[model samples]
Target: MKIQLLPSTFDENGTASRRQHLSCFVVDDRVAIDAGSLAMATTTAQKKQIRDVVLTHAHLDHIAGLPLFIDDLFAGLDAPVRVYCSAEVLETLERDIFNWEIYPRFSELKNKNGASVMQYQPFEAGREFTVKHLRIKSISVNHKVPTVGFIVSDAKTTIALTGDTAEMSDFWQTVNAETNLSALLIECAFPNELEELAENSHHLTPRNLQKELAKFNRKECAIYVVNIKPMYRDEVVKQIEELQIENLQILEVGQVYEW
Candidate 1:
């Protein structure tokens, strides 16, 4: 499996600059785990092949680029862009973001043949679905809104992404049961000093993360941390370093990996 964690931040030189941005991951050029920075992080060529997007939640940071991305590929789509999420998330998208006042509902827009340009495929948490060569399962996580973490695999190699969450149990239980798990991409959004803020917002601090990682069954799977707020990026990294957790590192934007 090949995964590229597209930068959540913007870069003036596009791919050449290699700057980081919001949370979006391109999975083998065929699927995107999130559309936060999908529009800005991807090149035109990469965009053409991304037929499906699996959203973890309805937060603006996660679904921000969907509307524009769909619009950008409006004329070229041979088929509709499939967005997979829970029903609650779909409702949030339809009510808040895709509604005409915020943005045109591309789900209602059509191509020359009169097919909707965007279609949402809702999945219940813990249910598994197949998209291309990947087998995906959504795990509910603790967040302020209705959010989910994804466990994606090709049957042989598997990886899990804990989308924004604070303290969660079911997600870890699910990950511990994955036999072929290769890597875990979890989020740590704040520094230890902001523990109160982290808890209130349903995010993790390095301290909270340590407790979370302790739940894992083994140390074999590589753990990469994501979603550190840009301003506190250094502090969070420093705090994480202080923990000295083995097999853990802060996820770098624009980085590509194969497992």
Candidate 2:
């Protein structure tokens, strides 16, 4: 499996920065785990190939680019863009985002060919579903709003990703049970100094993240940190580096990793 955390922020020189303001992971350039930077950052090839978007939640940063993504290819779509998400997420999207007042109800619209422009594939938490060639399992996680983390596996590689969340038990339990796990992508959204804010927002700080990582049984599995707030990213990275845990690293923005 190939995974690339698409870049959402850029520097003054027009180069992509390491700071991640949104969350989107392109897997094998075919399926997107989130549509955060989908409309803005995808390559021409990616834009043409990715028709399946699997969402973790309805957070703005996670779904910001979704509407635009559909609009970009609205006229040419022969098949509907399949969006895999939980029912709660679908409700939030319909009420807040796709409510015509905010954006066109693409799910209700059709292309020139009479094909639906977008479609929702809602799945309950704990149920395993298939997106293209990948099998995905969603586990409910502790977030301020309805959210989930996913365990995605193809025929060869199996990986787990914790979409923005605080400390949680079921996610860890499910991850630990995956015998062929290749990598674990977890989130640390705040610096250790802002532990209180992190807790209140249902996000993880480096300190709490360390405690959470203790629950994982696979010592050899590669661990990558993601979703640090753009402003506090450096501090969070420093704190995580201080832990000096072997096999732990930050998932670099815009870089693809094949496992």
Candidate 3:
């Protein structure tokens, strides 16, 4: 499996920066895990190939690019873009985002080909579903709103991703049961100094992240940290590095990682 966290911002030199202001991950360039940067950062090829978007939650940073993505491809779509998410997320999207007052409800619109422009495929938490060649299982995680982390498996690779979360136990319990898990893409969103803010926001700091990692039984599995707030990126990275965990590393933005 190949996964790349899409870059959400550019540097002064017009280069993709390491700082992540939004959240989106493209898997094998075919399926999108989130639509945060789906419209802004995808390659021409990726935009054409990725018709399936699996959402982790309905937060603005997570779903900001979704409507734009659908609108951009509205005229040419032969089939609807299939969005896989939980029913709660689906409800949020319809009530908050796709309401006519906010954005055109693509779910109710048809393309030139007379097919719906977008479709929702709601999945229950803890149930495994297939998207293209990958099998995915959504596990509810601790977040400010209703959210989930995922365990994604292709033919040869199986990996876990915590979309945006704080301290979690059920996630680790489910992940530890996966015998063939190769990697874990976890989130540490704030610096240790902001522990109170992190807790109130339901996000993780480096200090608590270490505690969460202790629940994992697989000591050898590669761990990649993600979703650090852009302004606090350096401090969070420095703090995580100070932990001196051999297998842990920060996942680079826009870099494709394969396992």
Candidate 4:
């Protein structure tokens, strides 16, 4: 598996930075974990190769760039883009995003191949599904909105990506149970001072993240921190460093990891 976080922010030099804004993690260039920064992070050819995308929730930061991505490829689709999500998320997307009021209902539209430009592949929580060579399962997580974290494996290596979530149990259990786990991508969005806000929004502060890690029994897998709100970036990173968690890393935008 190969994962890369796309460009979504700017640095002090006015050059594109990976510190803020929306993002998408592409695996093997064929499956995108989310489409948040798909269009901006990848090239036209890269976008065209994405045949499967599994969403964590209907939140804009996670699915914001999906509509435009589909639209851009509308005229040249070789096959329909299959979007995987929970039924709740699918409903929210259909009602709020692809409802025509916000964006065209690409799922209902077709390409020159006479096939739908996009399609929904709704999967229930806990049920495992396949996207090419990967085996994936979604675990419900404590987010303000309906959300899920994904556990992906390719037999030899397994990894988890917990999209915006607070201190939770089931997700940890799922992670610990994975024998071949190699990496974990989780969110730590606020600083210690903003614990209340983090909890209310179902996000994790570095303090909360410290407590969350206590639930895990294994330290073999690399834990990568993600989804840090731009305003709190420096503070969060400092706090995480203070925790001294072993094998922990901060995921960088445009950075790729192969396993």
lDDT values, one for every candidate: 0.89, 0.95, 0.95, 0.87
TM-score of each: 0.95, 0.99, 0.99, 0.96
Q: Is candidate 1 or candidate 2 better by lDDT?
A: 2
Count clashes in each candidate, considering only residues at least 3 apart in sequence or on different chains.
6, 0, 0, 0
Instruction: Kindly indicate the candidate among 3 and 4 with the higher TM-score.
Output: 3
Please give the lDDT score at residue 81 for candidate 3: 97
The candidate, 1 or 2, that scores higher on TM-score is 2
lDDT order, best first, reads: 3, 2, 1, 4
Please, what are the lDDT tens digits per residue for candidate 4 over residues 1-259?
A: 8888877866788666858668588888888988888766776667768889899988899898899888878898878889999999999999999999999989889877887889999999989999988999999999999899999988678889998899899999888888788889989999999988887899999988989988887787799999999888998999999999999989987777987
lDDT of 1 by residue, 73-129 (tens): 888787899999999999999999889999998888899867679998999999999
Error of 3 at 5 (Å): 0.3
lDDT of 3 by residue, 159-254 (tens): 999988999988999999999998999999999999999999999999999999988889999999999999999999999999998699999999
Pairs of residues at least 3 apart in sequence or in different chains that clash in candidate 1: 7-21, 8-21, 8-22, 9-20, 9-21, 9-22
lDDT of 2 by residue, 68-119 (tens): 9999999999999999999999999999999999998899999889999999
lDDT of 3 at 212: 92
Q: Each model's RMSD to truth, in Å? A: 1.6, 0.7, 0.7, 1.4
